[model samples]
Target: MRDSFDLIGIVMPSLLQGATVTLQVAAQAGLLGLVVALVVGSLRTTENRLLRFPLTVYVEFFRGTSAFVQLYWAYFALPMIGVRLDPLQAGILVLALNVGAYGSEVVRGALTAIPRGQLEACRALGIPTWVAYVKVLIPQAMQRVVLPMGNLAIDLLKGTSLLSAIAVTELAFAARQTVSAFGNPMLIFGLVLLMYLVLAAPIAAGARYLNDRTKRYVA
Candidate 1:
């Protein structure tokens, strides 16, 4: 019992620090991913084939590839071609782009799911295409996408653990370091899981809150 307590005492602080980094990576990546999703997903829906073609390729490429390989490519390969990023930067970029690809699908699906009648009504009323998207399609789509976005947010949060591979010192990395020194994999990893759960709770709650707020709009 005393040994367990001692392990907790030694490990908790390091884990907390790692959790902080994890949150930072997740937050930045989530925000960037939202932007990418909105832009790429929205553009891919456009009537202009010139515009849509490239964006379609982007969405497909990111969505189809393995995120783990993408991370290694971003961190290890990009530098060879003169596009170099620090470990944290690469981790955030890869995660944002990966989740952004997935999020874009959510955005596209939500937007496309809006009834054709509403769009026809907008056109009949002489609403510009952009205005229609902004005032009509997007707002509805946002409400629809909120729950899925929440799930993506949690996925992004969990994905931050992969940053340990690049030595970003996020939660999993910290856990690994603790385990190496203290020789307690089960205890260390159990605590790691708990910390991840703690980190994920807020994202889940925020998603539910946003979903509730948007329910009336969706209805």
Candidate 2:
């Protein structure tokens, strides 16, 4: 018990630091992902085949491939082609792209799910296409996507563990380093799980709050 306590005392600071990095990565990635989802998803709803085809390719490619591999390709392969990103930048970029692919579907579905009559009414009122999407379709879609986007947010949080693969020193890396130094995988990893749970709780709560609030607002 004393040894475990001592280990915690020794490693807690590092873990906290790593948690901070994890939050940073997740925040940047999640925000960028939301942007990508909105752009791609909104465009996908268009009748324009030119935009749809390439966007479809992007969504399918990222969604179809492994995120871990994508991270490696960004960190390792990109340098060979004369594009280099630091570990933090690579981690954030790949995660944003990966999560964005999934999020695009959520946004697309939410947008499409809006009642057709609303769109028809917009057209009938002489609303421009961009105005209709911005004022009417997008807002309603955002309300609908709260829960799913929250799920994606949590997934992005979990996905930060992959950053360790590139030596970014986030929570999983901190845990791994602690385990290497102290040799108690079970205890250290167990704590890591708890830490992740703690981190994820607020995202879940915020999503629920938004969902409930939006539902009330729409009602």
Locate the minimum summed-lDDT window of 10 residues in model 2. 210-219
Q: Which stretches of candidate 1 lie over 4 Å from their true place?
A: 122-136
RMSD of each: 2.3, 2.4
> Across residues 50-161, which tens digit of lDDT does each residue of candidate 2 receive?
9899999999999999999999999999999999999999999999999999999998998788989988999999999899888887778768899998999999999999
For each candidate, the alpha-carbon lDDT, in order, equals 0.90, 0.92
Using all chains and alpha carbons, the TM-scores for the candidates as numbered come to 0.90, 0.90
Q: What is candidate 1's local distance difference test score?
A: 0.90
Error of 2 at 180 (Å): 0.6
Clashing pairs in 2: none
The top-ranked prediction according to lDDT is 2
